[model samples]
Structures are given as C-alpha cells and as structure tokens.
Target chain A: MAKLDASGFLIDLDGTVFRGQELIDGAAEAIHTLQSLGKSVVFLSNRGNLSRAMCRKKLLGAGIRTDERSIVLSSSVTASFLKKHYPLSKVWVLGEKGLTDELALAGVAMAQKPQAADWLVISLHETVTYEDLNLAFKAASSGARIIATNRDRSFPNEGGHAMDVAGMIGAIEASAGAKTELVIGKPSWLMAEAACKALGLPPGECAIIGDSLESDIAMGRLYGMKSVLVLTGSAKLGEPRLYEPDIVLGSIKDLTELAKEGILL
Target chain B: MAKLDASGFLIDLDGTVFRGQELIDGAAEAIHTLQSLGKSVVFLSNRGNLSRAMCRKKLLGAGIRTDERSIVLSSSVTASFLKKHYPLSKVWVLGEKGLTDELALAGVAMAQKPQAADWLVISLHETVTYEDLNLAFKAASSGARIIATNRDRSFPNEGGHAMDVAGMIGAIEASAGAKTELVIGKPSWLMAEAACKALGLPPGECAIIGDSLESDIAMGRLYGMKSVLVLTGSAKLGEPRLYEPDIVLGSIKDLTELAKEGILL
Candidate 1:
C-alpha cells in the first residue's frame, strides 16, 4: 500500500508504551521526539474499565506525557458516540460506574428495567452482577441496540491480569444472539474515526502504533492508516515478522533512532 | 401424546417460581404441594452464573424449598456431563470459579492457555473477562468442540434478571459463525437425559413443569415426557395454551388441587 501524508499519531497502550506496570523501552523519549516534530498525538487504549482521568494518571505516573483530553479510553469514545447518535435514549448499562456516569453526563437516561430501555451499552463494570447482565440481555433481546467499547480479552491488573469488558459483552452476545451496534476501540475502524475526529484530521493523515497485530495493524488496515508494530509488549518476539507490519522495530528505541536520523520527520 | 407411567417431578426455577423479585403467587406452596405427594422433585435452572449452593441460597431466601443437590444449575450439569464423558481432559473454562471448582472436583484439568485445551464449555460466569471470551472464540475457531450450558436469554435474580450464559455464547457464534457442540440445560433434552440418568428412570416416567414454553415444553416434547405449564411465574395467564401442553394450570397449586380432587394420581 502507498503511504499517505499522515502528520498525527494514534498510539495504543499496554504493549506499545508499557507492559503491565513497567514502561516500554524508550517510549517516553520517542513520544517526546514525536511532539518536538510538531505532530499531534493521542493515547488511545481499549481498556474501558478505567476512566480517562485514571488512564491519564496511569500514563503520567509511567513518565508518559498526556492530559485527560489527550487520552481516550474505549468507554469514553463509546459514550461520545452514543451521545452524538442517540441522545436521550434510555440505556441499560453493563459497565462500571464510570460508563454510567459518562452516559449520564452525556444526557442519556439510564433505564432501571431492561424492557423499558431504549438501548444497551456493554462496558467494563467491576461491580456488575448477574442481575445487571440479565437486564442487558433482556433489553437487547427486546430490540434495543447494543454498543460495545472494545473486544479486548483481558488487560494488566495490579495482580496478574483481569478479565476486561469484552468477556462480559461476549456472555451477553451468547445469550441474546445479537451483534453489537458499534465497537469504538482497536480492531474497529470506528476507533480510528473517533481519533481522527478528535484530532481534526482525516484517517489517511494518521499512524497507529501498538504491539498487537490483531488490534493495531488490523485497525490500521481497516482505516487506511500506517501501522508501526513495536516489540516491547504483548506480542511474541517473532510476531512482528509473522504479522507483517509496515514497520517492525525492536521497540520505541527504533522510533527515536529514526527521529534522530530525521527519517521519521 | 399418550400419558405415560412417568412419576417423578422436574421443576424449573426462574420462570417457574418467580419473575425478578416477585414470587409468582403460590409458587412456594406448589413445591410444598409436590412434596406432599411424596414425589421426587428437582428444580432445574438454566442460569449458569450461580452455583448450586448459590441457587440453594437464592431459592431458600425466596421462600422456596431447595437444597444444593436438588437444584441443578447449568454450570454443574455442564461440568458433570464433561466429567462423565471425558474422564481425562483439560477444559478451558470460560466462566467463573464455581465452574472451575466443579470441573476440578470432577477430575478435569483446567487449561489456562487456549492452545492447551481441547474443549470449551461456555457458561454464565460473573468473573468472565474479555481474555476468557477471546480464548473461547479462538479455541472454537480452531475446531475445538463448544459445549454451552443453556440458551436462556435472560435469568431471574432477586431484583429482576441478568444476562444468561447463552447471550455471550451468541457473540462467539456471530464472530465464528458456527454452531455450538451441545447445550445441556432445559429445552435441549440434555437436561431431561441427565435427570433420567440420575433417577434411573426413563423419559416416559418423568414429568416436566415450568413457566416457559420454549425451555420446559420443548424439552417435554423432545423427550416424550408429559409437560405441565404453570403460569405463576414467567408466563401470562394463557401463554402456555399457545404451545399445546398436555395440561395447563394456574400454578402448582392447581396440580395439588387436581390431586386433592382425585383427578390426578
């Protein structure tokens, strides 16, 4: 594929900038170099369990330069999309209080009963119970459209790893036998569209850098964006070559090297 | 269908006893009434998230006479069936600890990684994560046999309802566009077979009673067991009449009344 004249960066977390609690090698320095070149960048993560503030705090704590607006968690994007597409709809939430709060802030009504809900939003909720899940299913089964944040399986937790919202969404899909209306995270073109809209740029004027082939590269392919696969996170050592990323490097260390050589700019 | 010499009682919970938090009028009394006839009765629920212990707790709390052993949750039946069929195999549990513990107690090994597993058992798990769901899709996509618990779209909780395991399984089916291996709970005939095996009785010697036409009456029809539709829970006053059940009653109370009137033995 021919390269487009992209001037902005849409970066993935987890494997691209950090893995678990540790920062990926040269991630902070490479991001700084990208900024010095006057490129607009947004840190996007499919982890919707945490709010944008929490995500920004985590990134800053890991020496990443980011602000609340510069960070877009999957939940935030989904909430924004719902607000734009279906304002005032009663939603049955299968997500955490953050999602519920976001929907509320977006002026959407939360329905107490599934049968009365106008729509369903499936997200990560730590306190989600069987009752909540059933309500979501019932609402969706009764013709309410479903909107999901991401399809990520699991993410790094303080302890090993925890099941992310995708699992919860999966359970609901199995029961309801319905597909979600939209997915506003990696592997879905909607994520790229959201990022482009947020940055005031077109899809062709952006690059997505991440560690997972299925998420980052697949998303790039879907949205016509350049994909840079980094090796410092979730991917196997040979996964970059196996998956055929446009640019396969050891880590952000190579990105900095490319910047120093003026090849990236 | 001719009435057979079936004598045992297999009752369904959720739709049978209550809807949401309100107990169907006379549902509790119906259980007591069935016991008064010295009949062997077991409450079978398709909700997979709750363990039999939890089911016992929920039912007893709802004023229903239920014990852990007499209540067969979908997870238990699924795990038990796997154990009986595959004595030595590693199972990738896409559910909660209850399912994991049950499979462990049944002498089945747990496969943490998807590639190491041969079979995928999809059930209701409160702790289900995106990782678990991804593994299920990947495993099933790679030709692993998929065994789901039930196809119930929604499950009743103390408050109202939650998504049943079938909902999540539906998502996997959508992604992979494949059918599941088996569903072992009500309406599938597998539940009837399990009941028959446990009681050492043939299908002709059993009678199925519940509040739903799809799960209860369908199983009865599939297994050639006499089905009695009770309208005290999920169904309306005349919903069961639409399915052509052998008998339709207002509740188990009606069953007891018929027995008292010497109309039923």
Candidate 2:
C-alpha cells in the first residue's frame, strides 16, 4: 500500500501527538516504532506563536522523544522563507515573544520603524494594541509587503480557543486597502515544502498523520502524501469533509496493528 | 427636478460638509438658504466616533448654524436602534468616548463585563487593545448578538484615512466564526429612517447630498429619496459607479442654482 511504504513521515504535533499536557495514546510508541524501522520522522507544528524549541520541550515532556531539529515549526518555515527570498528586505513583525524569538534566533533583520519596513510579517499577538495596528497600517500604506503566518481564526487555548493572528491581518488590510502577499502555514505549499525538506523526502515518499481534516489531511491531499486521520483531537467523524485520508484509526496506537497486517517493514 | 423638489435634505458631514477643520465651499450659505426656504435640513454624519453634540459644535464654529437636534450621528442611530429593538438587553460597547457617551445619554443599559453582555456593539476605537478584543471574543462565544455601527474600513482623517469599526468587527467575527447581525450606518435602512424622522419627511420628500456614492447615494436609492453627488469629497469623476445620482454639483452652494432654474419654490 502507498500508505505503508513511505520512507519519511511528517506528523502533526498538537492534538495528534498530545493534547495540552497529556500525550495521546500510542503517540510516543508509534514514533519510536517508526524511528526503529528506519523511517525519517519530522514533527510539523502549525502554531506560529510557539518556537520549535518550545514545541520540542513540550513533546519531550510528553515522552514523544523528539529533538528540535526534527521538528518543523510554521514560524521557522516563515523565517527560512524570508531569509531565502527577501534577504535584503527588512521586516516589521507583529507577533508574540516566541515567534519573534525564533525569527531573531534565525538572524532575520528587523525594521525599527514600521514605515521604513520592506515587509510586514503579521502573526498572533495576545496583547496587540491600536498602536501596533496603526503602525502596520502605516507600513502597508507606505508600500510594505504583507505576509501572514496563519489565517486560522482561533486555536485551542488553555481557556478554550483564543483569537489567532488573522485579527492582526484583518485590521491592517482593512485600514490600508491591501491584501497579504503570502501565508506560510499548514495546508499551504510553503509549509508542505518546508516539511518535505526537513524529512529529506519527496512528497510521494512521505506520509502525513494528524487529527485535523482541514489542515493536516488537506496538506496531505494537496502535497500528494499518504494521509491518515486519528480520532484524538479537534476533528469529529463526518464533519463536512474537505479532504479524505487514506486511513482512519481510533488512535496512533492502531498504527502498530498495520505492521501486524504486513502493511509496513 | 427631483433633486430640487425635496422638502428635506440629509447632508453628509465630512467630505461634503467639511473636511478636517475647514468648511466645504458654499456649505454655510446653502444651509442658511435651505432653512430660510422652510426646508428641513439634517446633517447626517457617518462617523460614529463623534457624538451629535460634537458635530453640531463643529458646524457652528464653521459659521453654519445648526443645533444638535438637527444632526443625526450614526452612533445615535445605533443607540436608538438598540433601545428600540432590544430595550432589555445589556450592551457591551467597543468605541471611543463619544460613542459611549452618546449611548449613555440615550439611556441604553450598558454591560459591565463582555461575558455578561447580551448584545455587543462594535464601533471605532482608536486606542483599541488586545484585552478589548479578547473580551469581545468571550462575549461572542457566550452567545451575545453583534451589531456594528459602520463597516467602512477607514474614514478621512487629518493625515489620511483612519481605520474604522470594521477592524474590531473583523476580529470578533474571526474568533467567534459569526457574522454581524446588523450594521446601522449609511446606506442602511435604520440610518435612513432615523434621518427621515429627524426631518419629519417622507423618503420621496428628502434628498441626500454627499461625496460617497457607495454610502450616501446608495441610501437614496435604497430608500427612494433624491440623491445628489458632490465633487467635494471621497467621490471622483466616473469612479466605477455603484449608485447613480440625480445630479452632480461642485458644492452644496450650488443648490440655490436649482432654484434659479425654477425647479423649486
């Protein structure tokens, strides 16, 4: 089966491997199994507000046994895309500390003034202010290119789903009469390209497993990866399907059952 | 002749009446002439961030004698609409002092906490904060009905167009995945009704003169009132027409010219 013969796998972090502080059943064991079988694995996280380092630590705490290098964060992908494509441009960022920290660590040049920015990177900021929005508006009106990390309205937060970065983008675009030039996050080619490069595999040689039909499963469908859906997170059964997966299981624990059926090495 | 035959006039404030501390040409003399001719004149302002009292005082300073009773502000229309449709509901307002002050003056019950709000009134707030948006999100998720004053992305400011209430609405809608229930502003039936009542005139007996075809002229078309386009503001010559007007003029001062043509008493 195409689903069983992948050399590399891009796995979603949140909801798939763990939920908040608790690990999903068989997630760690499945990763260990895949690694032992000589399959390359990369944890792909869609949350831009968290750096790869933080996600790695969180995964490690949950017994996922993954390093930072093996984790591909949306923010890190954004940083790399900027560094490679717009190396000479100065960016004005609107994000939380984690996203800014990742960009800083990646050595991206930041603009001191919004009006002087060559690019305005819009991301989630919990304490976003009118001043921040006004500055971004100024940057947009002054001809700065806009790029957003993710357009998801909300994400699962400790106290329920919190508003995401799209709010920040909506404000700037509304004021300046401009549209975002790029979006580097799940279900987009930019994100898919990043995950493939991290695992050193072509799209046809990789399988993706996650709990979200919109983001994770859609990514698999768009990038031509073998997709598997698990019932441990935000996805519900038969919820207005946008993308169909090759397999659906009770949990990652059932993945080991596939090998018993001679579906894998 | 339909433009000149109106017994009442709904005049747009900013680009048509005045622009940033300066009166448009013939605005003062035209209003005085219209008043002398026994025509009911109401200055209809779309800017919700300013109270009726503030607009009246500004008009009086520009040698255009007008009372707060004759000025219809969008915020006041929203306040009236809420008080009429949902008298017992507790409203949580996201606006500047002028809007809240007007709502308070109108005796609308205000909700102290966003979560406790029964209706969330979204308007323009220059110093909007993350806490405000989060609270709005909380209120929306708690099942509060949402109503916006205006959805104009921006309005003409001293430096340029300043962002309007749409940004705040965009944020709350994005988070809650809900659409605004009502928008009480220009081109909306609520605003038209309010303006018509203020002038004690029927839709056919009233004419709206303004710089924006999308807003002022559209209101006339929707409500069956005479619509006059002025070259003095946001509108331009042949700017991809949405609403066609009965006549176009250089300024409101040219209103008397219609009388010279024997079109009115």
Model 2 sits at an interface RMSD, in angstroms, of 1.7
Which 10 consecutive residues of model 1 chain A have the lowest summed lDDT? Answer: A236-245
lDDT of 1 by residue, A168-252 (tens): 7776776777777777778776677777877778877888888888888788877888888777767776433434567777786
Error of 1 at B150 (Å): 3.7
CAPRI-style docking class of model 2 based on DockQ: acceptable
Give the local distance difference test score of model 1.
0.73
* Residue pairs that clash (backbone atoms under 3 angstroms), model 2: none
Query: DockQ of each candidate's interface versus the true one?
Result: 0.32, 0.43
Report fnat for all candidates as fractions from 0 to 1.
0.44, 0.51
Give the winner by lDDT.
Answer: 2
Per-prediction TM-score to the true structure, in the order listed: 0.73, 0.79
